[model samples]
Target chain A: MEFLLLTEKCIWFGLGAAGFAVLFNVPPKTLIYIAFMGAMGGFLKAILMHFDETNVIISTLCGATLIGFLSIYFAHKTHCPPPVLAIPACIPMIPGKFAYKMMIGLVNLSGNIDHDTYTQIMSETVNNGLKVVFILMSIAGGVGIPLLITRKESSKGMRLRKRS
Target chain B: MIAPSPKNKEIKDLGNVLLNVGAMLLSSGASTGRTRNTISRISDSFGYSSDLLISHRTIMLTISDKKNDYFFNNLKRSAPHGVNFKLLSGISRLSWQVVEEGLSVNQINVQLSRLAALKHYPRWFTLLFVGLAGVSFCRLSDGDALDMVTVFTATVCGLFIRQEVHKMKFNPYICIFCGAFTASLIAGGGLKYGMGFIHEQALATSVLFLIPGVPLINSFSDMIDGNLNNAIVRGLNGFIISFAIGMGLLTSMLIYRF
Candidate 1:
């Protein structure tokens, strides 16, 4: 049963990645490669959360970093730019729940400024807001490092590497 | 060393073509590195070296041959941002082939026209997949079957409205705002009526379709790649889009009192 649930999560993550890829108009050939990377990243996060009992932030950072590394590899293999593959793959892990909660908390505060409810909502809002920032930053660092490293010195050594 | 032969016209035309190609790639949201490399490679194939200055909204190109007579043009325009991998890869391949196969400028022109005319997938196709992607996120978050269906339908409707508004050439921020509003409104309505067991999950996942993943990712890579100017541009673009989405979500929550 545990294995089944994990499989299901991985599958859903892959499907979601495919949907975004289509919207981004990714070339049909590399769609599966990106989907697989997205799925693996997402599954790794789930495994960390459920099996290893890690925090969401660390888990997501690891997953996004993995996606970042794979995106670079695929970019080289397929001769497409890394962003063309990495960006959509990272979409499935965006912290939408936290952002939505942050919005809700702000809206509630505006409505009831003097209540204890307001205080609780404020804390929740701050927490979620911070989570959103950290998650995004982690994803950025995770994905950016690989591309930044690979991009340097490439113009001189591998002029035709990506044009094939 | 100015050669006053008929080849002067050919050189000018070649310069024009190179400028056009650079402009198209820039407008297509290709990063500065890729755009510069592709332009320089194509011009080199024709025995003319080129220089480029690219920003988020403009491209400047100067093409010169052995005689050092320079032809230059600058384009000022804001490019609509959307990622199209096929076009990026196709143009890259074409530019490389220009060097490998020694294709003439006229031949390159024909290929450029073809690349520009490449067909995008239909609106309905993007809508279906974008919606499905939202639903899949819901599933990944452990939303129940009913919640998944709710998210799926809400996202599909939202993206349909977004595509229609985009077709009308509405500003992109407004399009994203409207899309988020419609999707959240449906999800909120479903929650109030007791249709889905997970209110927060559905509301959160339903609007995942508008998360601006591409711009955010691009902004990060741009900064790390040390294109700080372009990185700032892309980061600002991502910020405004996020603000628009927040407005849409908040408006829906206020209306529904959730």
Candidate 2:
């Protein structure tokens, strides 16, 4: 039942990725690559969800890094955009519910600023927000490096061509 | 007008060759200052013409003299009724062409560089994007009724709001809020009414609006074209946008607690 649920989720995500690609006018072959990357990312997210890790930061960072690597490879191989491939893949890893809960806490705290509850809610929100940022940064770094290097090499090639 | 000097003609020929090569390179996915320089050199080889070298679509070249007049005439036809084609020459023509074509690379670079650089987005396109997003949310929500009425209302509202707010030049923050609010209402209402798979199905589809697919693809193109700065900037922007969407959705969900 769990496997069936996972499969259904993966397929839905894949369909979502493909739909976005079509809407954006990405080529068919590139759309397939995006779908594959999204599925992989979703699978990773499912695995991470099962783990009993309390540290959201570390777990998110690791998950994002993996997605980033896979995204970069797919982007390079297919000559499609990394964001197109990576964003969908990383969707599952996004702390969407956590962030939402944090906002709720803030709103509730705002209504009644009793010291203890306020402090606790604020602390939790701040911590969760920071964790989200860290995960995003890691993903960015992982994806950004390959893109930078690839661009640098292409620029160098252009210069050489100009000199010749 | 005097006939151009022989040396000028040779330079012009070289320019033509280079520009053609550059355009071909760009079309084939080469993105560099070098390509622009090559095109520029070609443009400079011949005495500048208002119609031949630049336009709204691209910095096109007239390979022969006959084509030159045709290019200019096309521009003249396109220009506003009162504007005389001859009065507009040099950079002015080039810049006008860029506006006409939209801010594309190669053809519009010279014009784009000169403009005040306000971001331009079409209202219809934004409406379509938002409408699709709303529809996707409704479709993915894991319910039975599919919330057709809600989808229709949201689509119409999104279009109306986008058209009304488009001229205000507001930040994307507004769009994000609107998207989230609409998604939540649709989701909450659908789920509350026992709409079944409608809510679940819509989750995947609604999230499609936040997909950074285009930026990701453009990043690769920029990288391949050797525009590292452009590539990096684009990639970073995409990442931030995605993060913002995720954060926004999460926040909205918590506030309503649906």
Candidate 3:
């Protein structure tokens, strides 16, 4: 049962990533490569959270970083720019539910409410909103890692190697 | 000094082609490093070195051959940035061809136009997959079988409206706003009727499709590369799109009071 649920989760995220890839109009050939990468990311995050009991932010950062490194490798094999592959692969991890809940909470705050309720709702909204911001920050930091480390050497070297 | 350099037809033509390539890469949503490097590759293949000044909407290019003492410069402004990875990938491949195949300016130009003519997946195809994406989002959030159906219907309709509004030249933020509003409105029915296991999840996740994901990713990616100016511009662009989506959902929430 645990294995089945995990598989379902990975597949859904992979499908979501592929869907965004199509919307970005990535060449059809790249869809499967990116989907596999996305599934791996989801799988890794699931393992971290379920086994080690790590938090979502760190788990996501690790997953995104893995995708980043994978994108560089995949980009070379496919001869596409890294950003073309990396950006769409990262979409499935964006915290949509948290963002929406935060926005809804904010909207509710402007309405009639008691002081305690207002404070309670404000805290929840802030918490959700912060999660959205930090997760985004982590993703940014995570994906940036491969570029920072590999780019100085790889940008020139990698293309030359590919052509030769 | 640059003015003292002699002019040639090839230099001028190469200048135009490089600027067009640079502008296309910038407006197609590539990171600054990729844009700068690709321009460098092509210009180097032409025996010139390019100095690019890239902004959110314009790319200024100056190509100079150190040995020949000739230089040409041009600046091109492009439409608002749109995510077209095909354009990025195609130009990356073309730049390599310029180096390896030793293509001339005219040949590169022909290939570029060919690249531009390449067709994306049909609109219906994008719609269907994006809807599936929405359903997946619904499932991830633990929405039931029926909620998946509701979210898919909402997503397809919303994306169609957004695409139509976009073709008519609506501001991109307005297009996103319209898309979010349509999706949330459709999903809001579930919330109003309390039909699904987690009705608000349907309403909430429905707008996930409007998230300015690629822009956010690139903005941060650019920020990490020490290109602070373009990074900030792209980041602001992503934030404004998110704000528009929030407003759209807020509008829907007010209507249904859910």
Candidate 4:
């Protein structure tokens, strides 16, 4: 039931994304891909959030990498920018709320902290920070791979053709 | 490549402009250094002339002898109509290919003067305004009508102030801060007025403002074109822009308590 509910929510979000893309003058197909990627990214993030007992950063990294790769493949196939898909897709993975909470927590944290409180707060902050960075890195990696491949291929082609 | 006919020149020039704007937008929003590099590389591969690339540092392009007559003639025609040739030239350089071929410096200067006279805002302004609106909409979603209005008003005011300050050559950081501060005031007012829905709508709309559409497009184009560095750079820039907007909003909220 929860999975169904999540899937439904993702579809709605995807639709919203598609609408926005069209409204903004982007190609409809591009928007659809973005929406689909976003939904999947969100679902993966949610799954990680629910079942993963590992560090938040690790979980986020794993989830983002998985989603990002899928987004890249889709983007390549569609001849659209991966970030078009990845950025929206990663929207759900964004630690906006977590970052906000962390900011609030830090601001409210008294100077005096016993070991347990200090440890917990420190751990949480570190976890949230790492999660954000990890997610960002994942996005970078997803976009980077194709670019690198293309560059290598083109340069090699140029060199070989020059020799021939 | 076709021989440079008059019409061909115009078409090529237009293509260069589109490509340049697209590249810059992509580079600006990229999330990694690699993406920015990739865009530059891809742009080179696309055969953008060096002048377009160089003017990224200085907002000036040297006119070329080959294109001089054409550029000036067009400038003279546009000038009588209060159009600035320099601005057009600057805008023209948005593509490296056009820049490489050379353009009319004097005409472009005239265009800039005209543009200055017209007081046209930078393209980034529209983007910033739209982005703020999206953020405000998101915040207003908590169900506050007055809050929504306040955020809307504040965002507009903030954008106005930002434009004015930018005209005065204020620091970029200062401009961002002012924009965010004004947005916060609007958000707070919306909260005070009980316009949560308005705020939510603004926030939702604003999210699109930060949408790295250009960079994403550029990255994809670069990747497809086999220019990885350019693509990577564009992607990284997109991330930074998004992060900056998010941070600005967060800061505003923290300061305003709404």
> Considering every candidate listed, which one attains the maximal TM-score?
3
Q: Chain A vs. true chain A, TM-score per candidate?
A: 0.89, 0.68, 0.92, 0.62
- Across B173-195, the per-residue lDDT of candidate 3 in tens digits comes to 99999999999998997778854
Q: Please tell me which predicted candidate would have the highest DockQ against the true structure.
A: 3
Q: Model 3: runs farther than 4 Å from truth?
A: A52-54, A159-164, B1-7, B194-198
Taking chain B only, the TM-score of every model is 0.92, 0.47, 0.95, 0.45
Local distance difference test, per candidate? 0.81, 0.47, 0.86, 0.46
Q: How much is the lDDT of residue A136 in candidate 4?
A: 51
lDDT of 4 by residue, B61-170 (tens): 22223443333111110111111222322332322232344334334335434434443334454444344334333431232444434444655666566557667876
| Displacement of the residue A156 alpha carbon in candidate 3, Å | 3.3
* Model 1 alpha-carbon miss at residue A152, Å: 4.6
Off by over 4 Å in 4: A12-29, A53-78, A81-85, A109-120, A146-164, B1-175, B182-258
Candidate 3 colliding pairs: none
What are the TM-scores, per candidate, against the unseen true structure? 0.91, 0.51, 0.95, 0.49
Candidate 2 chain B, run of 10 with poorest lDDT: B80-89
Residue A141 miss distance in model 1 (angstroms): 2.4
Ranking by lDDT: 3, 1, 2, 4
Docking quality of model 4: it rates as incorrect
lDDT string for model 1 (B1-258, tens) is 876666677777887787777777766657777777888888887788787777886777777777876554545454676667667777887886887778988898899899878887787888888888998988876688788888989999998888789999999999999999999899888887865475678888888898877677777777766788988998899899999988988889889777
Candidate 4 chain A minimal-lDDT segment of 10 residues: A19-28
